[model samples]
Target: MSDNMFEFAFNPGEEVVIKIKAPDLKNKMGGETLQHLMGAKREMLLALRSLLDDAIARTDAADSPAEKTHIDIE
Candidate 1:
């Protein structure tokens, strides 16, 4: 993955709240809207895969050997 593919950001000293107003049903086209969202989700999955590849490469280079491994769920 290329660095230009996606971006991440943080707020230095504050939190933000966002609200979205969905399109009014009278103005919506069902099949078209569903197709658009499906395409967006596909792109999101591609982006996530790229990010994971980058992170794994960095971690493999930096980590020290340990005796045991563990997994946890949130």
Candidate 2:
């Protein structure tokens, strides 16, 4: 097994709540691959709420500036 890991932080001033050990990709059986993939998906689902909230906040901030900008196109 390799020492590879994935980490995601969805909010500022908070510790990373999701950490997944990377799947061994060099040579894996079908079941092994599926298991690893499912583990990663589960971790993502656990963080989905925070992730969605962060995404919405960022999109709103970006849209606000775009709305204030005036462009003239000929």
Task: Give the clashing pairs for model 1.
Answer: none
- 31-57 per-residue lDDT for model 1 (tens digits): 877678657657877776897799899
lDDT of 2 by residue, 1-74 (tens): 23555665578887666566755554554677777876776787768778879989999898885447778999
For each candidate, what is the lDDT?
Answer: 0.60, 0.69
RMSD in Å for model 1: 13.0
Best by TM-score: 1
C-alpha TM-scores of all predictions: 0.43, 0.28
Residue 25 accuracy (lDDT) in model 1: 39
Worst 10 residues of 2 by lDDT: 1-10
